[model samples]
Target: MPQQVQGVIARSKGAPVELVTVNVPDAGPGEAVVRILACGVCHTDLHYREGGIGDDYPYLLGHEAAGIVEQVGDDVRDLAPGDYVILNWRAVCGTCRACRRGRPWYCFNTFNATQKMTLEDGTELSPALGIGAFMDKTLVAAGQCTKVDERARPAAAGLLGCGVMAGLGAAINTGNVGRGDSVAVIGCGGVGSAAIAGARLAGASKIIAVDVDERKLAVARELGATDAINAREGDPVAQIQALTGGFGADVVIDAVGRPETWLQAFYGRDLAGTVVLVGVPTPEMTLELPLLDVFGRGGSLKSSWYGDCLPDRDFPMLIDLYLQGRLPLDAFVTEEIGIGDIEAAFDKMHAGDVLRSVVILDGPDSDSGSTNPLEAHEGEQVSA
Candidate 1:
């Protein structure tokens, strides 16, 4: 039987998000149904609400989430009911060319549930990043569920589903940050901060944080940055160079994803040093550096997609590190909120007031009488 659950959705482009009756169908074939425990409100979710991601209307919001496998289809084997798991967007298809090459992280054919979740009126909904989780329960492909230690809190562990994983992987997997390396991260938001933490976890001797906001720089220091640069105060490139003995850092990551920040990262590193761009950018944004400069850099310039993470390989290891107190996953979660507070969470996120505002779903039928959560932004175009 299809389960009737209360889930959040953006009914149209730039319209307020609506909490409506979502019909979650039972798992079929290689799919499983998960009972959501907690989910973080991400900037990407705000993007969906504002129609920044796509024209896929009625997008089921929320993706960074932790849950339990409540049920699985007959063919499923690796997952069973009661397994604690984090939902990931990259459900790698084993037969894809990327997977066949033993680099499934670049799997060209990631996937979601074959069957659709729908509105109570029978309208089909597009799941955000193929893992719509701002609800009591969500259905996903079996491969999308990665089991981890249950000792980790849902609010913190769920974050590894997206931004946190992106940042950490940017350093460890893409940038190839190594022990005793000098590293710098630009942005200091959720993703950038996580990259700082990743640098620390990778045993970096020095981690430099760059951001326009002072408060975020403080948070970045707590996350393990040895130095913080206020990008607005002076030339960040020069500052980074001065701090790294005039040679710049060994690895510099651009978490802001803008051309300006990218250029700053490009010049704020040692010759042949790696620059990893983890920050997302608008489609219209473009970069045009001198072709000579690109050739003269003499190092790798990389774009980190989902931090180039392999969920099955990285998620459990990160959760273990979190449990052992070696990683500061909990610090990334600034607050725990009710599902109804999503719009306010978005505002807080945009205002740089919080690192993360996660929704803690205690029960399957949880409700706070919120039908429309966008009262604060009514009729106003969300500035990109």
Candidate 2:
């Protein structure tokens, strides 16, 4: 049966999101209904509110989410109701050229639900990243739901759906950071910090974190960065080179996505070193660089889309790692709030005051950002 659930929606460009009843249709072919447990408040959602992603008005926001399958429509396979799942925006079509070539990560024909989730009046809504998970329930393609360990904390596990996954994939997949590699990540936000953690997990001997904020730097160290550079105080490239014994890092990640940061990352790597760009740039952003520098660099420059991650392959493995305490996924979640706190979470994210503000709809979540991993980074509160 079609049902109504409370959800957050941005009705117009630059308007505050409204908590209203949303119409979620019964799962159609190849789709499933997810009862959301936790969803992370991310900058991309803020971009939707600010009309940055598209002119798609009345956007259904929230994508970094964990939930349980409540219903599965026809043609769904290998997934059943009551599965603990993390929702991914990309649900690759198996017959796409990319998928047929065994590189589904570059799937050009990713998909979403065929039916629209709408307003009470039947106004169709465009979902952010093809996922509208800020509600009690959301409908998604069955392929979008990656089942993970049920024992995982929903607040912590949900982070894997987007930013965290991107960061880790930047290092592990795109960067190919390996044992004894000296890596430097520019930007110490959620994504960058996850890169640092990924570098460490990949056995990077020296992981340097570069950022303007001191608090973020502190958290970076806790997440396995061996050195921290205050980008505001000195040339980050120079600092990264200095820490890498004047040779430059083996891998440099531009998590900030700006021309300046990209340039710094280019120069911050050693000869033939890899440069992975995980940051997303605005459409108006442009870069003018020397052609000789590109030719002389003699290395790979890669852009990671969703960290080149295939959710099914990565999500469950990551959750297992988290459960084993090998990954500090909990560190990324600064606090847990209800659906009403989405707007404020955006404010805190913009201010660089928090790594993540998770919206917990059910199950236990942190009342305070007091996890063992967040001890050093915990100080100010984003809200009362």
Candidate 3:
């Protein structure tokens, strides 16, 4: 039987998201039905809503999520019901060329549930980034679920599903940040701040945060930034160089993903430094840099795909680190919101006031609430 659940959906480009009855089907072969506990509001979701990602209308728009597996396909053996896991976009297919080369992180072919989740009118909805999770329950390929420590709170644990993972992976995995390395992260949004935290975790001696918003820069400091560069005050490139003893950072990450920011990241690093682009850009946007400068830079220019993370390896390890207090995962959860409050959360995100406005799917108190628990929960703050 198809399960009817309330979900957030963007029915048309630039239109406000609507809460609709989503008909999630039972797990087919290689798929799993998840009872989502929490999911974070991400910019990617907004992009999807605005038709930036594609013309795929009625996008079910949430991805960074954590949940308990309620059912599994007959062919799925690794996961079982009652298992707590984080949902990831990259469900790498082992047979893909990238995976065959032992770089599953670069797997060209990812997995999504074969069967579609539908609206009440029977219109099939396109899942955002292949995981539609901003609801009571969602169906996904079993490979999209990565089991992690149940001890981790859903609000914090679910973040490993997207933006946080991308940022951390940009620094540690893609940038290869190391001990005593000087790192600079441009744009202190959730992703950029996570990169700062990752650089700190990797023992970066000088973690410089560059952003126009002072509030975000403050958050970056709390995360691990040693210095904050207000891009509005002066030239960010010069500022980054000044902060790094006039030579530039060892690794400069562009979390903003715009051509201008990418150029800043390019020139803000040492001659042989690495520049990691983790920010997602629109299709029409183009980047133009000097071919001479590109050749003279003498370093690697890389783009991080989902932080270049292999979910099986990265998810569990990150959750454990979060549990140990080494990584400040909780800091990312600026507020816990109800599913109804998703639209308002998008406003908060645009205002740059909150790092993440996560939808708490589980009831306020796990032991309390009516038979339909999602109805009883209210948005609440998690103290920073």
TM-score of model 3 (CA atoms): 0.94
Candidate 1 residue pairs in backbone clash: none
Better of 1 and 2 by TM-score: 2
lDDT of 3 by residue, 156-238 (tens): 89999999999999999999999999999998888998999999999999999998876677678889999998887899999
Model 2: residues with Cα > 4 Å off, grouped in runs: 363-384
Model 3 whole-model lDDT (C-alpha atoms): 0.90
Best by TM-score: 2
List clashing residue pairs in candidate 3: none
Give the alpha-carbon lDDT of every model.
Answer: 0.89, 0.90, 0.90
Worst 10 residues of 1 by lDDT: 375-384
Candidate order by decreasing TM-score: 2, 1, 3
Candidate 2's clash total is: 0
Candidate 1 lDDT for residue 173: 94
Model 3's C-alpha root-mean-square deviation from the true structure amounts to 5.3
